[model samples]
Target: MPPSPTPTGPRIKSPETLIAESGADLEGHGLKRTMGLFQLVCFGVGAIVGTGIFVGLSDTVAEAGPAVIVSFVLAAITCVFTAFSFAELGGAIPVSGSSYSFAYAALGERVAFLVGWCLLLEYGISVSAVAVGWSQYLNELLDSVFGVQLPTALSAGPADGGVINLPAVVVMAMAAALLVRGIRESARATAFMAVLKIGILLAFCAIAFSAFQEGNLTPFLKEGAGGITSGASLAFFSYIGFDAVTTAGEEVKNPRRNIPLAIMICIGLVTLLYCAVAVAAIGALGADAVGDKPAALSLVVDQVTDSTVGGGIVAFGAVVAIASVVLAVMYGQTRILMSMSRDGLIPRVFERVSPKTSTPVRGTLIVASVFAVPAAFSSLDVVVNLTTIGTLATMVVVNIAVVALRRSRPDLKRSFRVPLYPLSPVLGVGFCMYLIWGTGWTTWVQFAVFLVVGALVYAFYGRRNSRLGAAQAQAA
Candidate 1:
């Protein structure tokens, strides 16, 4: 048999070199570093506190029973591990593509392409899923004030027995228009939504506590470790937005210092909010009440207060809350595409920025177009599971990327470091894989099928155009 051709010679881009390349203004990529620490924190909070808190909390409570509080902590712990790696890399590279860029710098080109594709899938599905959630709340608000409702045939997707989700598609298009305006504008909008949602949450908490019963906390381990783990696995979705902050590596001021700080601060705040909401919810309404309803929080509030006003307030917040998530997530998606485009891993149109807006105009439009159909026709359940699988896949790649980068470039500047070194990343890998497994065999098959498709795309397109490959060829 002919000896297999020895694979050799493509030099990995060092963090310093990639940093320098990005420092060349994302290679003229238009994202501005105008966002300060406060805005960055707001972005993180905006992204982290959305759909999961508003929609997934009910399912989480059901999964773990009243013991769901433990699920919250476990999910946060896992994200913190991955967040440390994100901080280190975001600070070290300070680029647009989050894990894809990190993987390219650390693991090499082919792997980075895969990571980027998964991220594209992850962020895209997240935006669509959040938009669907938004539609539910929008309809609720309309019904609350005007006593009118959208038809189920037009309001839901295939998974939910609807012909198409009109509101979901419309919401995504609106977000796309907002994003195309400019990055600063997008940040301001997200920050405003962040404050609005947090205030609404605090308001919910104040009311929820009034009806809290100590007996609700009795069967804390109602589902046992398995249940808690399952709940945690699902709850892990809440933390996905934290990494969305890293996609702004080029947009944040003092990214190296601020990225890590913002990550910690946001994670801390989200964790506290989740715990308070979960504990109060289970205590006040019991685990049985928080169902698969899209407007679960609003319903929870209505039960706690006899007045329609409380529910109205929550429904109002849900409108802004899911929008905030969609905004941050869509922003992350565009930036990731822009980054990959800058790297020649995707089409050049995704790399083009509006000179007027200093944002990736073409890329933003593509993101809007890509998810519009799915948002209109697919079930929220299908999109949400796909998003989770993509999230887990991204986290697993990021964990390994951190470990690889640490070994390959010990001298690179990292303003933030993972505390336990190998343990943090190793555990990040293990826990992410475990959560992926717990997502069930069906999700695994779905993920595998997606990756297979991604590999084929990379082979046909990204393989030849890869910037790293070109550089390697020139050097050789």
Candidate 2:
């Protein structure tokens, strides 16, 4: 078993030690507790309800037929377990870094480091994937409004025969500019975009339901259990950022109470909306037709009304909503690095928050640049798998942390607790690992490669330089 801090040193920070330092206070570091439950939910919905609905659904629907409804529920069930763990930990910690910080307090430095590294794939590569998705919708918006489209070479990556995805890169830079302004401003922007997005979806479902046909649902299980399971695995990606609700920095008021409430509300709302939208899409357009569409909802709107206005509205919202995804994803990435840096596992440069903006300025810039370059020039199809694996891996760690903390520190007061105790965390781990296994052996190989690289980085710098490690060494 791993030591509380360092295996060989007496200067270890036990669960109790780290817990003593955890709270909602970070004013000395210039982070504020200004966000309320509603704002946190807004951030969660903003982070989650983007590309997955606009882009990922068709692929999922293709696999599950009308049973995509069941698949959405299956994916949400998996996320609910993780959501429970996240809420409990976020309530206890009330700080950013999400799973990474939770792992540190409950599992110690080395496991925490691995969680943060895997999260780079989740947040970093995820932002790139969302950027490319945004580019496609933006082009749709532009074509609708201006009757012009980006050149094929400029619209897609080299995999699609494009020289560069200039729009994708541009959108990421724009999102970074907003995030550098501060979390408050970014949250406000995301809320605004999220509202537009929800409105567009509501409008789509209304029009789509008018065309709803019962026949489309025939053979709902045409693909059977295998297809539904496959679809559920892919659909799981749709719920990626509910954890972002927990990582909303130290700027959340009454975090112990608000964090858990926000987490549940966010997941519940997104889950309901996803199921509603999936049903409407399938009913309005036959399952096969829905799968055929590049922008399924937009096409549904177009099909209902001869005027292109409805489709354009959906397109415009998608373009903006995906921008919010980019912002929120990058925000989570920087904050995780910021936390890791504060622990001396990474460079302190990331730990610096601008007093004026209360933002991790340098860290945000670095994340944006790294993601933007890759999204601009390369096909991210492969890396998207890495993102899925990283998310599942992080969820599994969080589940373990939840259980470990429950047993190790029962004396500590928790504002939220995972229901069914050991069962919740156990199922959380089992379900997520099952999904990860379904991702295939090749993806497992890629995940292993990334972890090996992360291990080397940790061995070289983190183990030697970590404050916790140093403290343990001194005590020894």
Candidate 3:
């Protein structure tokens, strides 16, 4: 075997250097660091509290019964572990890419590209999936509020007995438009949607809690440990967007302090909301009824409260919440691609900035195309499984990167550090692995296939085309 050509030196720069290099990128074509802690909190909250609560809640309830509360706690713990790692890295780097950039700096070109690809899977699919869900709620709201019923074929995706999902595609395009206009405009729109969604959730909780009966608490562990584990694995998707806040490292004022605070605060707040909402839902409808529909909260409200008004409000909230999720997830995806393209991992088109808007328009459009097909024809189950696997895999990489960076670059400055050092990162990896295991054989198979494809692409294209490699060769 030809002594496998001694692996070339790492093409990518270290995170510290990347941070210094990013100053130029942040100057003209990027967003201003004008967001205060409060606005940052709202961004985190807005992104984190979306489609998961609106669409995945019933799925969790069905899997774990009232034990969904336990699932939420378990998922939150897992998220905290990864979130701490992200805080440290984001603070130290404070760059555009989230995990993808961090992995590139800590790991290497191939690993970074893989991580970036998986994140593209995570965020792009998430946006499209959420958009599809939003379409359903939008149709429901239209029917309830305006007595206008969209044709079933037009309102649903092709796989769901529909020819096309017009509302979903339209919403995705609208979010893209907002994003291209400016970051501040997108943030303002997200803020409005976030407030409206939270208000509806609180209203549902208030009403549901008032009607809570002891009988609904029966068989709390209905699905046993296996079921709770499954639920936790699924519920983890709900917490996925908390990392989206960290992706705004360069856009937040005092990112070192504000980013970490936003991550921790958002996780805590979203966990509380999820637990409360799950409890209230289970208390009102019981596991059986909640399981009947994937979008359970809205269904439960229609059954328990005044059907007309209650259902309308829940549907309206779902519309706003899912829309916000699409916006945030798409934003995260485009930014990661932008960073990767800049580093020469992906095509240069992804790195091209729109002169008028300064956002990566080509990158955004590419991601939209990739996601649109899946959203237009696939089931939510497929999207959720793919997302979970990609996210868990990325978390494991992030956790390891944290420990590796600690060892390799001990002198590197960081605004935030995982409190227990190796322990926190170790637990983060362990938890992520456990959840990944919980995702079932099919999900594992799919993840494996995706990784294989990613590796092949990197070998054929990324290795040679990488800007990092070109830079290294020039320096040599």
* Candidate 3 per-residue C-alpha lDDT over 89-152 given as tens digits, one digit per residue, 9 for 90 to 100: 8888888788888888788778888998798667888777788888878877887789898897
Comparing 2 and 3 by lDDT, which wins?
Answer: 2
Candidate 2 residue-wise lDDT, 284-328, digit = tens: 878998888667778877887876788888899898788888888
lDDT score of residue 21 within candidate 2: 41
TM-score of each: 0.95, 0.95, 0.95
lDDT (Cα, tens digit) per residue for candidate 1, span 69-128: 888898888888898888888888888888888988878777888888898667888788
Model 1 vs truth, CA RMSD:
3.6
What lDDT does model 1 reach? 0.83
RMSD of each candidate relative to the true structure: 3.6, 2.5, 3.4
* Selected candidate, larger lDDT, 1 vs 3: 1
Give the C-alpha miss distance for residue 341 in model 3, angstroms: 0.5
Clashes of 3: 0
